[model samples]
Target: MTDKLLNHRAEGSTTAPPLLLGPSLGTSTVLWDTVAPELSATHRVVRWDLPGHGGSAADLIGPGATVGDLAVLVLALADALGIERFAYAGVSLGGAVGLHLAVHHPERVSALAAICSSAHFGGSQPWEKRAALVRREGLAGLAESANSRWFTPGFTVPELVADHRDADPGAYAACCDALAAFDLRDRLPDITVPTLLVAGREDPATPPAHLREIADAVPGSALVEIPGASHLAPAQCPQAVLIALRAHFSGGAKHGMEVRRQVLGDVHVDRAQARQTPFTARFQDFISRYAWGEIWTDPTLTRRERSMITLTALVAHGHYDELAMHVRAARRNGLTPEEIGAVLLQTAVYCGVPAANSAFATAQRVLAEEAEGTGG
Candidate 1:
């Protein structure tokens, strides 16, 4: 543990789980401005400036630096803030720092999201050239092209361009040197924490294929490609990045179980878990993470609305066995008996009377059981 080496801003309650947001090279903490504030509602977010960018001291790293050096600095900042462990998300070079942490310091990271980043950054020859260019002529030329490199055509963030232009030439060049040396392709399999890779569909820097490669190698890791986004996705399309981050860091199996119990009741979920076997373990996980965790937990639709949609879908598909179970779930989601009937009745026209008739019988039986359970 060391004193903070990076300039950073912390938000959210001290009791909340900490989440560190990292920035791309030549950009400052401003790169995270659009997303961090909202993320702080649930996470104690600490977005830091890279060496020589924003408020961090330009002397933090010199020429020939490595991403490991940056990782250590990030750890120092975490220690200074009294954060023993945290979830991590970053863009580009910042994302690379997160991958490094997950590989070398797994205990420190709870989860990870790498956006518009890569496993090796295309072998580093280009980075070496960029380093030489920055050291010789400064960042003016690069800053002028920042918009083209960091975003899609006609989309730009003036502050980020200025950050690039204003970054210390020596330090920026040193970061480029670090990029030249970074290559984590071999270590990708060693990452055990839940990982997520978000790619910009139009990004010329780290394209979707780069993130896909990571997804295929890191066990259980997921990938999300944002259409119409470029290199700096958080700035260009913060909502998509936020959704991905929230889902990735949403506690996975544990949170899924919580939502599962809430929707289906404790008895059902407990019985399901108690019956889980080695052969059925993966299926159980898929239900929890995919159905309960991802779909059921999405806030876009209220649980009541979801119940209605679910009941209708179940009837339409003739899943009467499952429909009986969800009829109870619909009640738990606050749908009255009549409301559930209405949904099933709507299915009569669309799903045919045969399917709706069976659905009605199942719903009636489940409702009777519920009535008996509570003296209704």
Candidate 2:
């Protein structure tokens, strides 16, 4: 693998799963600075600069390099880092690299988030003209225009513009050539990894419509449009982009199962599975698919928040049995006994004293049983 990639481990832990990041052509890994730190809390972030940008050498991109060729370099980088499988997020040309990897090397990708990118970057003539212009006059000829395309008004990052200016023109031209020949529309259906496509509503470079085409073609892929962003949505609107990436990477059926087990405990989940008869199998699947898969797996709220909400709702509805179950879940989600009591007490004001009283009784019994079992 080319030693061009930069790796940053999350500050608190080294055990998090790896996440590879790619930048748009002419930009360096610095393009991801806004979101990478937040993502690093849950992932070991590995970001790479395009050839000729940042630390990567211009000579590394040989003549006529294709997007597939860049995909190979990414896989090589992963292999070098001993990452057998990883989540990936990229922007523009970087997103194109992600598509190539997801399509051709499916086993290596755990999940994918493509921002302001397309399966096909439209007709080749524009790319050809850009490549020719860069080759003749260098990136200086196109830097201002390219920077303008990347962000909506008042959202530009000076560093990102500098990245474009610093890039080797020959390498940038080669990337343009790559974009010219890249087309993977037919291969979208073959991707099985959970995928997210983010588009900027104002992006003149790769508009929301471009991402919509890929989303429709890729089975189960989700598309999101950031309202006022342009090409560099991740940089311009980091919070929105981070939310989408976090959900895509960490919210899914498998993740839902993990969250379910964590909330309900392994014993409860195993017992529920064991009690499933053919007649009840569909019910179990429904809970797993909808309740856990759809609701519990939402990344917008933490498990603790959901637990508190669930407990309150159950008490308000006078669902004592469910309230009892969720009382145990609330404890598992790190809710303290005092906090549980507070939720029950609050229910009295909104849901009536009788409902809170019954909920209190049920929760007290469950909490006692839990305390006794653990000798706490």
Best by TM-score: 1
lDDT of every model, 2 decimals? 0.90, 0.84
Angstrom error of the Cα, residue 52, model 1: value is 0.5
- Candidate 2 shows a clash count of 0
Clashing pairs in 2: none
Worst 10 residues of 2 by lDDT: 5-14
Candidate 1 lDDT over residue span 248-359, tens digit each: 8866566788899998888888888899998997688668866887688879999999999999988888999889889989898999999998998999999899999999
1-376 per-residue lDDT for model 2 (tens digits): 3555433223214577789899998788778888898877667888888888887878767657899878877787788778899999999999999999999889999999999999989878999998989888988767788667888777778888998998989988999999999999999999999899999999999999999999999989899999988998878899889878876775544566777798888888898889999899657755764589768876899988998899889988889988888989988889999999999899999999999999999989998998889512
Runs with alpha carbons beyond 4 Å of true place in candidate 2: 1-12, 252-376
lDDT of 1: 0.90
- Judge candidate 2 against the unseen true structure and give its global Cα lDDT, from 0 to 1: 0.84
Against the correct fold, how does model 2 do in TM-score? 0.70
